[model samples]
Target: MLHPCVVVSGVLLSLAVPTIISMESCEFSGMPGMPGIPGLPGRDGRDGEKGEKGQPGRLWQDKPQKGDQGEPGVMGPSGKRGVVGKPGPKGARGHQGLPGEPGEASHTDATQQSAFSVARGTATMPGRSSLIRFTNVITDFNKDYNTETGHFRCRVQGTYYFVYHASAEEKLCVVLKLENTIVASFCDHVQNHNSRQVSSGGLSVYVRRDQEVWLETGDYRGMTGKPEGYSIFSGFLINAH
Candidate 1:
């Protein structure tokens, strides 16, 4: 160890008081302090991985629109025919109708009552209405003709057919009448002055019930003779309305 006070060769040496070296003895030990500035931000992190698949959601309400129409279906087969039903009961008879009016002429018989007369001789007066008695009543249906008066009083309303025959000596003229109306006339002259000539006639007239028909030969002169049934008057009802 070297003493501080020791000197050699006439020189003085001294020592400082601090025992060891400190930072204060270095170059910048007494400088003032200052805050540090912030640095730039770091880069953003990468995207995360995908999550698990979710469950199907439930329906909340009905759909608003109508569905589209389907195509038309095929036609069905026809059904079999059914059996016939039973017959119905008979109906009740209806009431009788009103009585009908009289029928037509076809309803009457073709062969009906007829009238006839035959005469002998009856001279008639001229300018006066006269009746020649048809002396023989051959057929007088309904007893309507009068042989004594030479008149046929009709008993039924109908169309009637009439006929007459007369024979005379010399010359004889006669007129036929219905009631007061003259209908026909006949004239006959003598043949060979003795054999006698004949005349005849026929007519269809409408005769009402109670009307009269007769033959008159008294006009101008009178009828002379009669040849049995040749001189006759006859009538019949042809039809009735």
Candidate 2:
């Protein structure tokens, strides 16, 4: 009758012998029960494994603190035009100027002394362009020659010379005018009508101011005066414009 497995092993050895004698009779450890109410923040942690690349930082040697003037960059396009230079050296010679205020006395040197010489004191026979009346006055200096209008009045205005000499008996041809323009001529043709002949002439002319100059007779006038000889007329003023 005790074969039910020895009655369950004697009821589990009498309940494990009173729980091992109540944990060996409990000797000290009983007041730690007031820190148990904070447990709800633990669900975000799963990503950490990738780090290896750090070693290259050392080149800033002290001149790297000038960086606050950077806002002016956009204007560059205009450069190429230069080549032309060579011409210098030549200047030296100037100093000699002061000697001028003394020039005002030449109205042709105050009317440059005109001149004349005349002769013809009787026996005249002038006709045909007539005007040969030189009534004797040897040298009329500045009297401008005019023994009663045989004309020569050109006060002073240039080169003049004029000359004449006549003494005739039968055919003479004279002429030396200026206002009617003829300039020079003289002839004497006396084939012995009791003999006498002399006709001379000269000229230079360029007279102008009152302008007259004269001595005419073209178609033969037979001029022979003063003791039957000597007839003269002259003019002077060489240069005086």
Candidate 3:
């Protein structure tokens, strides 16, 4: 009930108790005054209530110093094609290589010699597919046989090997053409017309460049030539193409 600053601090404590008892009987103690002008900065406090989540810090074991090379990471979308890897164990046979620069001289079986044989000295009877003239040359290496065009021309261009032999006495049917296309044939039905039958034949074709080959005679011409029996026609050149 006595509040006006507590009744003015009880009347200044009874007037400062007789002026501190007359300054404690007056003596001397004075000189200490001039220091007071610094007081206006204090009003900012209100923020304190959110503090409970702090126990997770121990993971720094020291391996992190390789930095400075990073500017290349924008090319990553092409990576899904990788399942074909099983063919790698057969590679050790290589060291024999440096001897190559010397070519361009081929074709030599004596320059791809096309051969021939020919025969038929006189006993002709060729009509009914004609062409059997073969005069007689036993072995004409490059003449390519043409005893007045009985044909064997193929100036060398493939597998030849033709052959023939006749010596008949009555019925023979030799054939062996190539451009006219009969390939090969030979027959002899000489039931002993005094005995003379030799007929033979052969094949292996594929001639090309000029291509002729002959020896006809289908409706039996009975070809027996020379003195009494020899009628050949051979050919050669078994590989060139």
Clashes of each: 1, 0, 0
RMSD of each: 21.4, 19.9, 18.2
lDDT of each: 0.68, 0.84, 0.83
User: Which pairs clash (backbone N, Cα, C closer than 3 Å) in model 2?
Assistant: none
C-alpha displacement of 63 in model 2, angstroms? 74
Poorest stretch of ten by lDDT in candidate 2: 105-114
Error of 2 at 133 (Å): 16
lDDT of 1 by residue, 71-159 (tens): 99998999899999999999999999999999776755533455655554444322334666666667777777786676888877888
| Candidate 1 displacement at residue 160 in angstroms | 1.1
TM-score of each: 0.47, 0.25, 0.26
Question: Which candidate leads in TM-score?
Answer: 1
lDDT-superior candidate, 1 or 2: 2
How close to the true structure is residue 114 of candidate 3, measured as C-alpha lDDT? 79
For model 2, residues 1-241, the per-residue Cα lDDT tens digits are 6799989999999999998988899766788889989999999999999999999999888876777888999999988987877877877878989999998885545458788888888786777768889888889887888888879889888998988888888888998989988877777788887887787878798988998988988888888676758788888988887
- Model 3 Cα displacement at 90 (Å)? 40
lDDT top scorer: 2
Screening candidate 3 with a backbone cut-off below 3 angstroms (N, C-alpha, C), the clashing residue pairs are: none
Q: Residue 148 in model 2: shift from native, Å?
A: 21
Candidate 3 per-residue C-alpha lDDT over 1-241 given as tens digits, one digit per residue, 9 for 90 to 100: 7789989998999999999999998877889999999999999999999999999999999998998897887776887888998888888798888888988987656757778888888886677667788787888887778898788888879998888878888898888888888876777789988878788878788889887888888888888685868888888987888
